[model samples]
Target: MKQGGDLLSLVGYQLQQANLRLETDARAVLADFDLTPAKLTALILIRDNPGCDQTTLGRALSINRSSAMKLVNILVEKRLIERQPGRDLRTNALVLLPEGQRQVDAMLAAVHRSDTRMTARLSREDIQTLHNLLTRLGPATGAAED
Candidate 1:
């Protein structure tokens, strides 16, 4: 197969291409649940971290305050999450509702299946090596694992 010259040799370009393909698969999986990647991620985070606030969730998701608020509001409207009084009066603690938990559980499995399908061409060792290399390329901050 013909490669795209020097661009094909660039790690960033390769990673972007891979990410786009993965995201496309993810979107297809998410579409069944009427969810987006961001929304599903937010629900998972809320489920994992009980009583987490919007600001904290936003930081973890690398989004700003306003965007976080909008996301939270949509979740609230969808009845997928609820905002309760936080430790501080200024912030609202986020929690996944039962429906949200159910959706997340189902979506998680679907996404995993999608990923498995995508990586079917790779051997176990190849997958592990790819994961390790990607991890190494991630930011040095421990938060990168999240």
Candidate 2:
């Protein structure tokens, strides 16, 4: 088979390029919600883990404490999420406000639209196969556990 070069043949390079495009598209789609991918992730994580704190959120998203704080602050300022006293006096539990819940649904719908557009070129079977291969490489759900 003909190949452009070793650089073009590298799986990591290809994946990185794909990720950049997807992130750009996701950011555009998320714009109407006034959310970035990190912020959207923060909201989703908080929703899924209602009692989780800032430190947990940072670790889950592979971001530093300051970065986490920035995202948290924005969400709080927007009244989309709130911080309440946690089990530990020093920690604050993150919870979505009513507005956050409504925004979450809208954001999810927008993201689904982006996903549909992105995958329009792939058949259902092809997409399934790609998902299976990716899971074998590194399962998205299990990454945090590791």
Candidate 3:
């Protein structure tokens, strides 16, 4: 008996719509670098966690091992990352090459640009509050558990 047709009033619906819009904008922003958000995220993680192994990377990225391997393969092919023998002979540790580091710096700049554009309508205080709220929500909902 609830036929108000006010879908926008639902918080979950609004969140989903906003996420979709952000994804669209992000894809456009990252197109120039031939990267998706996941790829950029992986590169940044690999850069920050030097000598990290594929299993650790996949766990951090919330992806499966196969998917992680594929991502690493693409980055290696692009000459953005390299793999070296780990402490154990069976493990391969990932490292960002100099080119990868340079690209990651550019990627950070691009992310900042996107963030600025996305939050243009919000005041700095509002943005900070929103970030705080989202940080709380993610953990509470276990959406960020991975």
**Clashing residue pairs in candidate 3, if any?**
none
TM-score of each: 0.90, 0.89, 0.86
17-129 in candidate 3: lDDT tens per residue? 78888778887888999989899999999998999999999999999989999999999999999999998988999999999999889877987888889889999999999
Model 3 bad stretches (over 4 Å)? 1-9, 140-146
Off by over 4 Å in 2: 1-3, 139-146
In candidate 2, the residue pairs with backbone N, CA or C atoms under 3 Å apart (3 or more residues apart, or in different chains) clash, namely: none
Task: State the TM-score for model 2.
Answer: 0.89
All candidates: CA RMSD (Å): 3.2, 3.6, 4.1
**TM-score for predicted model 1 compared with the true structure:** 0.90
Best-first order by TM-score = 1, 2, 3
Cα error of candidate 2 at position 99, Å: 0.8
Give residue 91's error in model 3 in angstroms. Answer: 1.3
Best by lDDT: 1
Comparison by lDDT, 1 against 2, better one: 1
